[model samples]
Target: MALLPVDDALQLILADARPIADIEHVPLHEAWGRIVAEPLIAMRDQPPFAASAMDGYAVVAADTAEPGATLRVVGESAAGHGFTGAIGRGETVRIFTGAPVPQGADAILIQENARPLETTMIGVVEPVQAGRFVRRAGLDFHRGETVIAKGAMLDAGRLTLAAAMNLPALPMHRRPRVAILATGDELVPPGADPRDDQIIASNSFGVAAIVKEAGGEPIDLGIAADTLAALNRSIDAAQAAGADILVTLGGASVGDHDLVRKVLESRGLELAFWKIAMRPGKPLMSGRIGPMHVLGLPGNPVSSLVCSHVFLTPLIAKLVGRTHHVQAVDAILDVDLAENDLRQDYLRAAMHRRPDGTLVATPATRQDSSMMRVFAEADGLVVRPPFAPEAKAGDAVRAILLRHI
Candidate 1:
């Protein structure tokens, strides 16, 4: 079958993917990068009580407005300590930041605007407004309010908020375990002394790294020979490992050595989609065997990485309950593109910021998807849509940024 467009293939894969169940609870400290399974409701109003926002003298605004007015500081209120004394008319209390506002004192005059008469008294140097410098209870957050919503990714700030709300732990989804299996008789593991016909199996490492970056745990299943028995054994091992996702590195095309489709089907797997009309990754395939989602990537180095960026990353995000996940972006093209073929081309390019503050992407000297060195040096993929006529300079183009230029 001919390849489908990239967007169509993505729609098909996403339609079949189910969000993994949220079935784990982790302590707040260990919850970083985890997705919240439930909404985090505030146990108490933030601040819990009315507090002073500054170090100043709390007083009755009606009496403190008269310049040089003297008021006795009934007591001192420091953070974590409440002034039990009440401040009636012509009475005041010395307060510090975070201290609860004393009763009957509706306003505060900052120390810079007051003259200290003693440790317990001060002369008002300026007028004070009612309720000034008082942070009302629940101003930051109300009691029983949802501080963080479900499916939110926990970060340092979110964890701090959860702790502030007295949540000792959070319900989070378990990290998906992904198994990466590289297949090919001509491929050897890294550090092996390869024969002239053999090439180092480097795609697995890249795939595993991408999996980890996408919030999934990658288990490298090592390289499998092109033979059916070897590939079947490798698949069995991956299934036995309880992997949530199984990613095969090669043998997804129609060639005689491309045995991934047949092997997966023989094991009763359901094929979702294959052969996206995207350059460098047109042979990609996705399916499911039992409970495990399978992603078959093209053998070429750049093709594998591109497909990972397009499909695997989103799959991992979906499994972890993450939303709004997308790759980086760039500005419009600086030059024209020739007529496109039937496939979408993800051209490797170097992207940089121009002096005018616009993002400019230039395609690399070599556009071959198998060139690992050039792929490594590229900062993004400049997208070229299929059937597009000649594009002139200044035409808008979408590019997925890979890294800093």
Candidate 2:
């Protein structure tokens, strides 16, 4: 049978994905990067009282009609303290920034615009207008008003807003949990002394990083020996951990040692599809086991990372209610091209900003699947359609940027 298209596979992977319904009460200072579960209302008006915005005289505007107008200084007002008496005609209060504007004062006369005549008197050197340099009550926000909408991501700015609203704790959606398992008897974790034929396992680290970056909590299950019993034990642990998504690396393709698909199926996993029509990651498996979504990735280093960028990140975004996605853009090819076949191609490539401000992508000479170094140094993946025609250098192409260069 032909392989499933990339778009179709993504739709299947995300079909059942839904934002978690559980709500958590997170402290205001620790609510960053969480999704708001309910609308955040202001508890009190920002700047509860009319405040002085400058370190100068809080005056009745009519007292400072023109330059050099004399006014008697009544009392002093500093931050967190207010003048008890009201300001009358031809009288002003010595006020500091953030101090409550005294009653009957309509404006502030900055010190630069006023000359001190004595400890209790000053001459206005500039005209003072009503409501100038005075922060009115409720100017920023009002009591019982909605400050943040539901489903909004609690970024740094939003967290500051929540604090200003007097919110001690915020209602947030629970974070999605992802469990990752790596298979193959030849694989070992880093820093371990490996035997002659064994190699360090790396796919799980990359996969877990992708999950965390996409706003999910990743629980590493370590490497499971290539046996059905070991695999079953790992599966049991993942389910017991209450993981919402389970990701398994290697053993996805049909091989003598590949037993992941068979074991999962025997445990009642509903296999959605086995493969996709994409190069660098064709033998991709997607299915569901009970309430947990499963993604079986290819063993090749480049293939696993590419698939994670294409599928795993999107699934995590859907589960957390995030709206942004990695986007593909048109670019110029800086090297010669060749014709393609049935599978869509994602070639690791370096990108350059040309003198004319155009972005150019040049594919690596060797497009091997196991080369982890290539993917590391690559700025993007140069995309080629199936059955694409041969092309020359400087031709227009499309690429998905891994990160900003």
Estimated TM-score for each candidate: 0.90, 0.93
lDDT of 2: 0.91
**Residue-level lDDT for 32 in candidate 1:** 87
Which is the leading candidate under lDDT? Answer: 2
Can you give the lDDT of residue 218 in candidate 2? Answer: 95
Poorly placed runs, candidate 1 (over 4 Å):
81-89, 192-196, 322-325, 328-330
lDDT of 1 by residue, 1-405 (tens): 878888888777677677788478898888888888889899999889888999898888898766678998788899878888787897888889999888888887888988988877788888888889988899989889999999888888898899999899889888888999999999998789999999999998888888877888899889888888998998889988889999998898888988989999999889988878889888888888888999989999999999999888888888887753566675767666788899888888877897888888777757888899999888899888898788776776788888865
